[model samples]
Each structure stands twice: as C-alpha cells, then as structure tokens.
Target: MTETILLTGAAGLIGRVVHHMLCERGDRVIAIDRIGGENITACDLTEVHRLYELAATVTAVVHCGAISGPMVARDNPFLIVSSNVVGTANVLELARVRKMRRVVCCSSVSAYGNTPAGLDLVPEDVPLRPTSVYGASKAAGEHLLDGYAFQHGIDGVSIRPAWVYGPGRTTECGIRTMILDAQAGRTTHFPFGCDFYRQYVHVDDVATALVLALDMEKLPRRSYTITGGSYITLAEVAQTVKRVLPQADITMGAGPDPIDDVQARFDISAAERDLGYRPYVTLEDGVCSYADWLAAQR
Candidate 1:
C-alpha cells in the first residue's frame, strides 16, 4: 500500500536516507526541511500554524528534525530544548489534528543520559535521567506523545536510536571519524573511555525500522529502542578502523559518558517481535562497506 509520508529534516543524514529509501521503494515522500536537496517544504517547525499546514494531508510522518550530536547539544542547551521539545510538540499537535494514523518520532539513547558506573545495559522502562538539554527535550517529547496517545487515541511510535552511521552521515560520530582520521594519519581522540560499550547502527537500518514501525499492524507502547546487533567497546571500534587504514593515527582522550547507563545496549526483542525489526548489517560489515566508499573519496 503506497501512502503519502511526511519526512521532516529531509536534508539531514537520517532524513535523506529515509527519504531516498522511500522514494526508491515507490512510496510517496513529502520532504520537509530548512535546507539541503530540492522539493522540500522549507519552514521552521517551531511555528505551529506553518507546521500544521505542512503536516496536513499526510498519512504518516517520520519526525527526524531536531538538534542532534552531544557536543553540539552541549554548546546550545536552550536552543536544543526549543528546537527538539517545542518543535516536537508542534509536530505532535498537528499529527493529532490531521488525524494521521502513525507519527514516527526520532528519539535518542541520550535520553538515558549518563549511565551509572556499574550498570551494563539499559531497557526502555528505565527512568529518564537526562544530563543534557537535548536528552531532556526528547524525554519531554516522549511524555507529550504518551499523554496525546491516551487522550486523542492517536497512534505513534518513538524510536530511541543509538550511534547511527553510514554514507552521508556526519564525521563527528565515532566510527566514521576514526576511519577518516586514520586515513589522514591524524591522531583521533577517543573520549568516554576504552571500555565504554558502544553500538553502531547503520542509517539504512534505522530507516528500515522507522518505516516498519509506521506500517506495522500493531505497535508496542508507542516507544521502542532500535540498536545495532552487536555491542563493542570503543577500543574495538578503533581497532576496526586501524584494520581498514593501517596508516591512520589515533589517540585516546578524556571524555565522560554523557548518558548514565553503563552499556548503551537496547533490547530489540520488542521491536523484533512486534515490528519484525532485524538489523541485517553488522558494524564490521557496515564499516567495511563505508571504508570502501571512503577509500574512493580519497
């Protein structure tokens, strides 16, 4: 069934991937963004009336527009809250009024905030103790959805994704930067300890999860955490980079884990069982594929 999908942040990495994926599969995508690519409805989502107008007539919405990145989030705490929280509120409001069947929200693992020292993994029901304004904003948005779902009986799904990387992704993320730095023979700093467990899901996989949730017959509790298949330490991530580019120089730096959870692992059992969410590509496979592309860039 081909349905009209409203994709926010269509110019960003996630938005671009999801938009293109949908387009290729013969799904109708109404791209919305402030910049990047053409055929976009350029307007700030903070404006309620403007946002509602843009959201009108769409069957489903993939809400990916927000202030992402830990360092960037730290730089502008207030802006993060305003853009992510206030803007998300507007999206939810419009989705309700438009009577859209599904609104897929892009949440982050950062909503968990800094992980405690001993805890190994985190689950969805875990209390949100966000350290950054970005995380707090996402938590607030989640609460809004929870309330709206009960009140309006509108269906929604919030995907809390972890460490998404692939082609067209930003270099700030762990694995991609390491590969770039290694190839340039630049010393890359690995903050947040060597033992800090990390998960890297490809952007395509994340996009697949979003589409599945939107089209699924049933959803689980309006929220699900979509993580990559494997969890490895930062050291392992760095090692993989080294294998790809032996000349790449990298170093360790002091950076604290922003989230309170010990290991950033999401139990995908719910998503798998409910939405048939399976991440076919592993980090190694993704890195290798990405490295091949990176090699071509040089």
Candidate 2:
C-alpha cells in the first residue's frame, strides 16, 4: 500500500520539487502552501485547526512549510518565530494527536551557528548555537521534533540542508543574481563575502534527502545534514559563473555576508550511511542549470 503524505510548502523551492517527485513515484501527496496555487491547498501552517483537519487523510507529514531562511523577514522576528517555531509545534501536535507514522522536518544548516570557532565542519551531533533569529527558529523546531519523538513516539526527524539553491527559488541568491546579471548584460559586484566559504545544496538533492528520511523505517540518528558535497568560496562560485558566462563581470569584497557568518561545510557521512543520501548536482552543473532556467524566464 502506498503512503498518503501531507506535504507543506508545496509552492516553495524544495517543496515543489518534492511534491513532483512524490507524485511521480505514485505516492499520494496532499500539497499545501500558505500561498495557493492550482491543486495546492492554501493554508497557513500555524493554523492548528486546519492542520488537524488534514491529519486524518495523511499517514505521514513532510513539514517543509516555514520562513525559508535568515534572509527572509529579517525585520520581523515575530514572523520567524511564529511561522517557523510555533508552526513546527503545531505540526508535531497534529502528528501526535493523529498518531501519524512519521514526520520529516525540512530543517537548515544555520542551526549549527555555534559549532566551535576553530572547527567548521558541522555534523548532526554538534550543539545548536544559532546566530540569527531564523537560525534560532530552526533550532527550536529540531528540539521540538526530538521532544515529540521521545514523549509521543512520533518517529520525527529533521533533514538539515545548507544554502539550498536551484530553479524556482525566488529568494536573494548570490549565484542567481550573478547569473541574471550576466544574462541581462550587467556587472555583478559584491562589496563582501570574498573570503567567505559556505556550503550549497541543490533543491533536488534536498528533496532526495527528505524522501529518504521519510522512507526509512528506522533511523539511527534523528537528524541529517545535506550539502552540495563541498564548501565553496565566492571566488570559486565566480569561477563557475565565468565558465557559464565568460563575459560576465562579477567581483567580491574581502569580508563574509554580514549576517550569515557560519563559514562551514557539512559532514554528510551520517546522511549517506543512514538515508542512502547522495548529492547529485555539482556546483558547475547546478549553476549552468539555474542559468538556463533564468535565461528561459527572460
């Protein structure tokens, strides 16, 4: 028998891809997003009553709905807390009340903001030291998942992905901006993040990790990190962009992104061994693909 799953954030970056993959694999998906689209149930994730209403229909929940990242709603910490933290609480409650078989949370790498100054590689076991409100919200959600699993046997897990990027992403992405500038014949200049190095995972790879977490009957670890398989600096990113658009003019300054200071790559061995997760997109290929998508849009 196929699993009937309730997938949130159905219209967002990774969520949309996961929705397509799940349906193509013959799993029934009840796709929901705060923003409504055709075949997507329009509802806020924090609406406890609405979430509960759909609980009976789904045997599992992929809680991808949340304030996407630190860049979003930087001015409104309340939205971040309410939508990410409280919304997570609400989803866990629905799973608890409904006795859902499993719940896989779409988490973030920012939760490891405090992963020791000297050592940068973040593993699942690192203490959550969140630097931003958005990071704090994601950390809180993971804690909630652990609590629910211990207390209610919810089979909850979190897939923490880093610097997620791919087609359909509407957020402020450095790579996307550079590619668009190249396509539009504009110079892309950044005053910072030249020496900064961080991870990037394609949205398709993130979807693969989420699905793996959902299908695994038993997970030895409650959380996993998914990355693009390497940490990339701005110079490396620029090089990849130049390969795609040789005429593109892009430059960066000497500092990192002001807010996102977590200069680290992720250890995916746990995710690899446990979930059979593998990142398929290389930086060059992902950038090329994203550029193709952006060009088509123009």
Highest lDDT model number: 2
Q: Write the per-residue lDDT of candidate 1 for residues 43-65, one digit (tens) a residue.
A: 77786777767666788889998
Instruction: Estimate TM-scores for all models.
Output: 0.91, 0.97
Q: All candidates' lDDT scores?
A: 0.79, 0.89
Output the lDDT of residue 169, model 2.
82
What is the RMSD, in Å, between candidate 2 and the native fold over all Cα?
Answer: 1.1
Clashes of each: 11, 1
